[model samples]
Target: MRTVTVLGAGSWGTALAIHAARRGRPTLLWTRTPEHQAAMAQERRNARYLPDFPFPEGLRTTDDLHQALDGAELVICGIPSHGMRAMMERVAQDFATRDAPAPMYLIAAKGIEVDTLSNMHQVLAQELPPSHRGRIAALGGPSFAAEVAKGLPTTVVVGSEDAHVGMSIQALLSGDGVRAYVTDDILGVELGGAFKNVIAMAAGIGDGAGLGDNARAGIITRGLAEISRLAISLGALPATLSGLAGLGDLVLTCTGGLSRNRRVGIALGQGKKLEEILAEMGMVAEGVKNTKSAYRLAQQQGVEMPLVSTMYAILYEGMAVREAVQALMGRALKAEREW
Candidate 1:
C-alpha cells in the first residue's frame, strides 16, 4: 500500500485525507497547531474544520510536517493560499535535509496569493527545487468538502506541467465517489480555479439581494465569459475554460451554499460591514483576496473584466453593491463577443 500525506486539517484537507484513506492508501494528515494535533489524535475528529467527519482508522494525524511527509509516496499539500509560501519554505527545507526524497507534491489549495499575486502552482514552482517543479500539480473542480466527505460524487481536475504526473495523481486520488481528470496546461487549471471564487461572490450578492434566479444566471453566464477572455490572454487554451476546472467548478461554487466567499458576498449585499461578516465567518473566503489579485492581472493582460473590477472596488474601496451593479449595467456595448 502507498502512503499519502495531506498537510492541513481544514475541511478540504480533512476531506482529502479521508478520501485517500478510503481508497485503501495509508494517509497522514498534518495540522500546524499542536493543540489541534492533540485533539485529533485523541478525539478522532477535526474540531473546527470538519467536525462531522471523524479521522479514519487508516489516517494518522500530526503537528510535525516532516514526520507527516517522510517516506510518503504522494504528498497532498492542502494549506490555504495566503499561508502557502511559508509552508512551502518548510517543505523545501525538510526535503533538502532528508537522507532521501520521496514523491511528487500535489497542491489542493485554491486562490491567488494576495502578496505575490501568483497562483498556487506558480508558488509551488517558486518554492520547490527546479527538478521537482514538474511534479508539483494542482486540483480544482466541482467539489465542496462537506459533500465529498459524505460520499457524494465529485469531479475535479489535476493539472501539472507534465501530463504523466497529472495522470499519476488522478490514479491515486480518484475513487468511487471522487473523480479526477488530468491536464498538462497547469496555467489554465489554476486560472480557472482562482477566478471562479471571484465570480461566486457576484452570484452570492445577487442571491442576498433577492434578485431572483434571472440575475444569478446572468451573473454566472457573463462571469464565465469574462474568465474565458482573461484565460485566453494568459496563454490558456479556450476549451480548458469550459472543462471541469472552469465552467464545471464555477457553477458549483457560485451556486453552492457551502462556499464561505459566497457567504461573505451575501452579507455584503445585505448591507453588512465586511469586518463584521469576516469576523462572523472566521475563515478565509478566498474571493475576498482573489478579487484584488485577479483585477490587477486583468489590467496587466489588457483583459476587459468589468465584473472582476467592480467586485474588487466593492470589496476594497467600500463601494456599495448596488452601485457596482449599476456600473456594470451602464458600460457601453461593443460587438458583444470576443473571437
Candidate 2:
C-alpha cells in the first residue's frame, strides 16, 4: 500500500524495486542517466542491469528527481557509497520544494565513505536534516541481487536507531518468501556489510591461489573477529555482528561464489592485473574501495587487523599477494582469540 521510490535503477536497485512491485506496492524507480531511464521506460525492462526481469506494469520509471520521489512514502536509496553524499545533496535541494514528509529513508547502499569513513546512516545525517535522521534505516545482509530478484527465500536485517523503525520496515515488506528481522544497531549492520566485502576478497584470493578450505576458513573466522571488533568500537552491539549483518553475510559473500569482490580476487590470484580484472568485471566491487577505509578504521580504533592491512597493500600499494600471504603467515603467533 506504500508508494516506494527506489532512487537508483542499477542492478541491485532495480532488483529491490522489482521485489516491492511484486508485493503490489506502487513503486517508482529512478535512474540518473537519462538514456537508461528512457530505455527502461520505453521497453518496460531494465535490460542494462536487471535483464530478464520485466518492469511490472503498475511500477513507474523516471529521470526527474521530483517526479519520482514526489508523494513517496518510502525512499529506498540503493546507490553506491561513493556517490551517496552527492546524491543526497541533489535530493536535499529538491526537497525544499515539497512539504517535509516523514517518509522512511532506507539506505540500501553497502560501504563506508572513503573520505569521512562514516557509515551510510551517518552520511545521511550529515546530508539531511536532523529531524530526518530519526527516520533513517539500513537494509543489509549477504543478498545477491539475482537471488533476491528471483524471490529466493532470503533473510536480511533492517536496522535503525530505534527498534520500532526496523519493525516498521519489517511490517511494510514481510511476506511469504522473504524474511525481515529488526534491530536497533544500524551502525553494525552497515559496517558489517561494508567490511565483509573486503574479507570476501581475501577469501577469494585464497581460493584462487589454491590454498584450500583451511585457509579460507581461517580468513573468514579472523575476518569476523575484526568485523566484530571494529563494530563494537563504534558503539554497536556484539550480537548484531553475529547475526545476518556479520556472520551470515560473511559466510555468504566470502564463499557463496556470487560476490563480485571475491571474483576480483580470484582473477588476481590467477596472476591477472588489477586494472584488467576490474575492467573485465565492469562493476562496483566495493571491496576494492573499502580496503583502504577498513584498514584506516582498524588503525584508528587500535584494532589490529593485519589481514585487512595486507589486503589494502595488495590493492593499493603494489604489494604482491604472495608476499602478503607470507607476511600474514609469518607474523608472531599470539593468542588465537582476541576477545
Candidate 3:
C-alpha cells in the first residue's frame, strides 16, 4: 500500500484521508492550523468539517508540512483554488531542499484560480520543478465528501498525461465504495470538475426561484453544451466532457443536497446577500469565484457561455436572478446542434 499524505483538512480532504486509511494505507492528513490538528488528533475526528466521521486507526493528523510530506508516496491536494498557488509554492520550497524522490500529486480541488485564470494542474506546473511535474494528476467525478466518508458507492476519474500514473492511482483508490477510472484527457477532467459548480449554481437559482423542473432540465442540458464548447476550445476531448467527470459530476452537483455551490445559488435566488450566505455556510463555495474566472476565460477564448456570463452578472454585478433568467429565455434561438 502507498503511504498517503492529504493536504487540507476540509470535508473533502478529511473524507479522502479516511478512505485511504480504511484501505489500510497509512495516511497523514495535514491542516494549516496547529489548533485544528491538535483537536482532530486528540478527538480522532474532524470536528470542524466532518463531525460525524471518525478517523480510522491508520490515519494521523499533522500541522507541519514537512512531517506530512515525509516518506509519502502519494500526496492528495484538497486545498481551495485561491489558496492552491501559495500552498504549492511552499511545497516547491520544501522539495528544493529535499534529496528524496517527490511524491505523486493528486489534485482534489475543483476550481480555476481567480487571479491567474489557471486550472489546478497549471498552477501545479507553474510551482513545481520540471522533474516533479510529471507526477501530477487530477481526481474528479461525482464523488461527494460526506457520502464517500460514509462508505457509500462512489465513482471517480483519475486523469494524467502519463497512463501509468493514472493506472497506479486508480488501483489504489478503487473498491471500498469508491471506483476509480482513468483518462488521458487531464485538461477535460479538470475543466469539467471546475465548471460544473457554476452550472450547479444556475440550477439552484432555478429551483430557489420556483421556476420548476422543466426550467432546471433545460439549464442542465444547455449548461453541458456551454461547458463542452469551452472545454473543447481549450483542447479538451469532447468525449471526456460527456463522461463521468463532465456530465456525471454536473448532474450530481446541480441536484444533490450536499452541493455548496448550489446552496449559494439557492440563497441568491431567495434574495439573500452573497456576503450573508457565505458567512453562514462557513465553507468555500468554489462556484462563486469560479464564475468570475470562467466568465473571463470564455470571453478570452471567444466561446459563447451565456450561463457563465449570467452567473457572473448575478454574483458580481448585482443583476436580478429573475431578470437574468428572463434574458436567458429571450436570447436568439439557434439550431440545437452547432455543427
User: Which candidate number has the best TM-score?
Assistant: 3
lDDT order of candidates, top first: 3, 2, 1
Q: How many backbone clashes does candidate 3 have?
A: 0
Model 1: pairs clashing at backbone N, Cα or C within 3 Å? none
- Candidate 1 Cα errors over 4 Å, as ranges: none
Q: Write one digit per residue (lDDT tens) for candidate 2, span 1-339.
A: 658999988888998888888888899999998998889988998988778888777688999998887888889999999999999887777887778676788999889998989888988888886667788999977788888888888899999887777788887767635788888888889999999999999999999988899999999999999888888998888988999999999999999877898998888887898899988877789888899899889888998888798898898898888898999999987887743
- Which regions of candidate 3 are displaced past 4 Å? none
Model 1 lDDT per residue over 1-339, tens place: 668999888988999999988888899999989998999999888888788987678998999987987888888988988999899888888888876654788888888887777888888789886667778888878889998888789998888887778898999878859988888777888888889999999999988888789999989899999998988888887777899989998998888889887888788889898899999987778788889889999988988898899899888898888888788888887776751
Best by lDDT: 3
Write the number of the candidate with greater TM-score, choosing between 2 and 3.
3
Cα lDDT, model 1, residue 232? 83
lDDT of 3 by residue, 1-339 (tens): 557999999999999999999998999999999999999999999999999999999999999999888888999999998999999999999888888787899999999998888999999999987888998899989988999999999999999998988998998899789999999999999999999999999999998989999988988999999999999999999999999999999999999999999999888889999999999999999998989989999999999899999999998999998799889988898888961
Q: Where is the poorest 10-residue window by lDDT in model 1?
A: 330-339
